[model samples]
Target: MASKESVCDSYLSLKPEKATIIEIIRSLFSSDLENERFIESSEEGKLERKWIILVSVIVQWVFLYIRVPLAKIGDVLQKWLNLISINGGLLMLFLNWLRGKVVEPDSLSSRSVLGNLDTRIELDKSIKPENTRYKAVLSIMAAKLSYENKDLVQSVVNHHWKMKFIGFYNFWNGYQGRDSTQAFLFKDTQSDPNLIVVAFRGTAPFNADAWRIDFDISWCQFNKVGKTHGGFMKALGMQPENRWPLELENDDQHSQFAYYTIRKMLKDLLQEDENAKFILTGHSLGGALAVLFAGVLAMHDCEYAWLLERLEGVYTFGQPRVGDEKFGEFMKEKFRNHDVRYMRYVYNNDLVPRVPFDDKALLFEHFGPTLYYNSCYGGKVLKEEPNKNYFSLRWFIPNRLNAVWELIRSFILPLVKGSEYREGWFMRLWRVAGLVFPGIPDHIPQDYVNLTRLGTLLLPKETPKVQHSE
Candidate 1:
């Protein structure tokens, strides 16, 4: 393990599990944050920093307390849903149950909470490998599919998509000391030179730890590169003890770190086929990791320049801000230097992309071109999405009205857009929930999947290049 002294100069780490409720409250009023047991800061920080840290710690602490129960609830809910799915809908399920002929769901079945919500596992046949928008369409599907178990992902890749199923990984997080991050890789053999995609899994609905990562505001500030989200860094396999080393020694007893293991695999794979290029993609938290993977490759440019050169693009859906303004600028310069294309997809009022609050207090900001799409799947290339901060009262009524339109659209879509575009009851229920909180249903993969398939037609022929004016 690398020593703390060998690590970067500045970092602010939050350990909510170590903090007591009284200590958490006391942190709000106290100025000496370095002295707090739950916090490990390189220097004394501003009052605003304390407020952000306090909120993060409180949220994480709450999540830590509820983690087990929340997971249990998710497990039970998944099993029950799978049970219904196995018997072919609720009506059939009840009939079969009464007849004692209902089938039990397999432990590692195709059913998932996210899958249950959208219920569309197969790719759109209308969008083929030869289409101009094929890569983007395939990326969103892979991102959506990453949320499922290995067996299901493999089945979809090999059987449905007719692609090579590389592997699915659950990598170790050094900070959390657990296998928390997940990603899958596959090759699009239908295309020339074969495009490889690395899709990181997004946050699960009932996973408290995943939610904690989204809420954690801890950061590590590099000298010239600027501060990055600590939670995201850890999820991407940044070691607290050794920090972000380019290489790690092999140990059969130890678990794999995402960056190291994935980097090694990509290096080997690319070596075998020089013509092949790869894309990084994800949704929500996974999106953060996807871009950060490229950023880290830039950080070690001398060693990983080849990898960056071969990186075709990064496609993210409903991704949040990962770093400060400086970090954004750094990434923009790097992408420009390498001529790498980055398309960030945001659907309507999705709240994930608008956060860790892009304000004077918090330093997190998003870079790259956002392919913004509305609830109706209308597309626009913009630097940022509208309603930059999602909590404003002015847009509340409009958001609710849009949610109403979405719920109505759910019923009418199947009739107009063909049966393939049909949404399940769970998704319709989520749209109903969106009536109260509009962003919730908007952030799902279903809309993103819809956008990639339909938004291409709505996009103008002459779209603008990357905007860095911000």
Candidate 2:
């Protein structure tokens, strides 16, 4: 019999890395002239006889202890056991055959060459910036309170695009403050009045800058409350813990707030001396708000239509399902001037993407192409173990068990429940286990990969040169 090391050596000599999987299998099964004579001469036949005797004795003892009296029952049990043993032995033989065939001699060389070539090309491209007609600016808007603190506001806006992070408080203060708020404050002061990008951040303590983006735009909160109104803070949902509002604020309040702010910005932009286009983008809660505001703009007719006609586009990231199906369809149709592209990024089997909304009345009827990446796969391991085999029985058995368990929970459990299984105690446990297990790969969101690809493609093309005048 050939030693394990000798078998491995022989397999590696075949240059499995350069060959296809089928070719590798063929090579392993092909008769080798040198090894044939040794196998024929070996006393492995005697060893096989001894193993069969041992198995027979064990089977006889098991049958005696079980107290099965009939000779026919004993004979049937023996036949079943023999069949199981034969199949198990065949499985092991096949696995060993694969192991010998699948060794890749030049894997390291191939991987290294590819890595080096990619790195060199990327390095060369990063050094140079391209000049393009359109400048891409990422505006992160803040919620109400951030606008009040001038220092915080200044810090956020000081960087690129003079981005301002506004919150509900800022909106309230801006509109209802001691002095009447100017409707289109930022729009009045932009350098290139032709192109504008407006993005909103959702909820309180808004900090859009927390997420990395290229540009920043000054944001002003549009207070969405009127008299017979609770205090400004209460309407904005900033009341102290003890004073939480008992009733949910109407969608109209939120819609009006977003509409007023957007209208003011548009009026100021159109009123400016130069002609420019505008684009709107937001994520999550902000995305819902952006859609609402866009719908309102469409409703106001030509004053807004003429302005939006010059609009470039709208991109909402991870936006919840919002508006009735008909309203959603109406909004998309009415906004003919701009293309409303909604991008939802889900992470690791997250349930947030399935927000409650009428499917038949979905505003954005079309779902864009989905791009997948393996970032979350193989779990985010900092280091790989040395001398670890990618395919091993030890690794496969547990993985197979895990796969079976997941299929039962994800597929079977739902059938029993008569509905889709929500992530509850049992689901959470499995997710936690998946995180720990190396065999089970993690799931990554398609949007995250798409964004990265977009960044790579665009980043090399241009670098925004920030200009400052003291």
Candidate 3:
């Protein structure tokens, strides 16, 4: 043991060698053991998928265009590569823009949804209900909210039995990248009389940076209160600017217009109807916005905090982790004591909830009491691992792999599996590229909807009381 230790020490002390420029270049760019692990975990499957696709593409081309032999597959693959090169970055950008822009009937007040800010949303007050489990009904309604445009939004409300259409307020905004915000108001006629819900939409996959998984953040504050739990002068130190996350606090180009606007609207709403019960709900990006909006209302400096106190609950599907530990502590205390039910629903491996990657510098944290939906516990609350969070550099590769699998599952796999699906090679390749680059498909709103449905879109026969807010 002594001899081995001495030899090891001698080897460690003898590193007085310099590398050639070639060696430096190789060290910088070469794949290592970690890279090998990544290949075993992810790239191998991708390679298998790629070969399957190449053969399929060749067979497809030969059948449709040329009666070429199987030996000519390499030529066909080269030709496809040439075509992709011709299309290049601009084509990918345009395709991304197209994918993110979900096609829905136009908003009534605005000519086109993605084209302008919408000040108004049409309403229908004629709907009435017959024995609906309110929160369960709302769960479905929230999912519907994500897929429709302003024009079709009213139709959904009119069709549901649990809620009455109040109105929707649309604002074109973004904190860092461009996005549109909608504050959907609905009267909970079935469960809580005079109840108002403000549902925010998540990222529009077609919007700017919809697919961007970048963790870049600007630290700001949760509220105007300079109060921290502990400091020198007092037990709780005050952060005048809140010193939270800037990107989470503000999403628009200039100001927090959506926050202030909704604040006023909620104030006026509760003012007119003293019995009004408020709930904030959103999915994906809208879920994050909903948290920010709630934070704005929950902050100490909020003059209209009284108006916000009536907030009955907050329900977010696949919500991203919002702020650092302090901000999270603030949110925990604020929402916990307020008789607010912060019921966050997470679908199986839904990637949105996993992101904004928790960093000490960025300080993104998931506010809990999460409802783990899917066959896991039959859609009941997941009680495991309280007050704990998980984040590791190990997740990136698998997430990318999942993202790619999701795209292939969406389009290519169906074709290979002999499903009644048909799509050209251009689209298949484009979707694959989207998966490889952004993996936004892993977080798409449609998957959440399907997960919530439990293998069927039928409305529940009875409202599951599990959804009711305290």
Candidate 4:
């Protein structure tokens, strides 16, 4: 109890319960509709209403001793109905979220919308920065959809697409050659096999667990790193009694799952020629994995070392913060003089970049400067200011909603797809729910593709020069 009190002393003088209550009043009146889209506004409203009821009754009892709306207890009953309606709506939304909807593969999926870029760009030539980033977005989208109907994937171009498919993987529990991380190399059909896209896939539409795993905040030490690597002063920012947000445990980065998937790729892909060039790219979860893979490969010896040496650049869309400052600083420093360009592309109101950060601890910082795709000012990809992460009462709610959503998505998938497909229904609920609980809509691969297309057109015409140390 003494220890608890001691720890409590360091917190901002505001009472914790008072803080939540303040949130209630603020939320009840808030008109921020954009934020309302990703959160369960109905649930928050109920908290506000409950507090209002408690306060009103207390005032009545103190002033009159007994106020009789007792005869019109119907009003009290009506409030219950409102509660049911709000909760029921959330429940339905939750159910729809759970009933895991499978993404039907599109050959013409947004990635191929790169128009003639894929068929045109060659290995001998330097790729314009925008086209390189576009390919990264394409890689991530493809990684996520790799498990879609083979016909659907091959359906994009020809019967021969997957036949020439190189290094596509199927890794998961009981994966019958179809599961998450359905990543594949684009070399076989590319302008140059030597210049390949190591597209790690993003979260799949069918697997709630994939997104859940990606979003999980439990940080473990990165790969083989031993100790958390920040100075005492960084920790000094928090009151000593304040238990550091576990997410801020400096050495512990988001590992395990992404590393597991990436480890599967290291051995096979190492067989490429010495001069082979790999452009690493992906969206969302795939983006995080690309960094992990690239970082770990950079630390390797002999054969695998070339993976980093020949790495052309990394382009990711809406990726979350993956590592503590050490990992960020390590990658930042390691790539500082190297040939690789690690860049994260973000657009609109992407929330992923702000997350995995608990209480704004300086634990996780980004690698390179963000290549912000600004559509508001003009459609262009430009370097933005240094990033600072925050913790919001608003952001916390969606993660919980997503967890419940994942549970629903995993077990209730049967409801999503019967012999008569429910694509129409699934889309309707997803669209409606997105309006109510707006979580990461911009994180979607298509949005990334569309936003990137606009930004790419704005990229400077001059090709970025490469410095080859070899």
Cα RMSDs, all models = 2.9, 31.3, 17.2, 17.4
Clash numbers, per candidate: 0, 22, 19, 10
The C-alpha lDDT values of all candidates are 0.83, 0.32, 0.45, 0.42
Model 4 TM-score on a 0 to 1 scale: 0.51
Q: Write the per-residue lDDT of candidate 3 for residues 10-120, one digit (tens) a residue.
A: 000000012333443343444341232111222222232222222322332233222233215533543444333333434764574578842222243222221111111
All candidates: TM-score: 0.94, 0.37, 0.53, 0.51
Candidate 1 achieves a global lDDT of 0.83
Candidate 4: where is the Cα deviation over 4 Å? 1-144, 154-163, 172-181, 222-272, 301-303, 358-362, 374-434, 456-470
Residue-by-residue lDDT tens digits, candidate 2, 243-336: 2222225644432343454555566655673476666655444444555455445544434566556655554444444433345445546554
Regions more than 4 Å wrong, model 2: 1-150, 160-194, 204-256, 337-350, 357-470
- Candidate 3: where is the Cα deviation over 4 Å? 1-133, 136-140, 143-147, 159-162, 172-179, 209-216, 222-256, 374-439, 451-470
Better of 2 and 3 by TM-score: 3
Candidate no. 2 TM-score: 0.37
Winner on lDDT (2 vs 4): 4
Candidate 4: pairs in clash: 37-437, 37-438, 38-437, 38-438, 98-408, 98-409, 107-156, 143-201, 144-201, 228-251
Cα lDDT of model 3 overall? Answer: 0.45
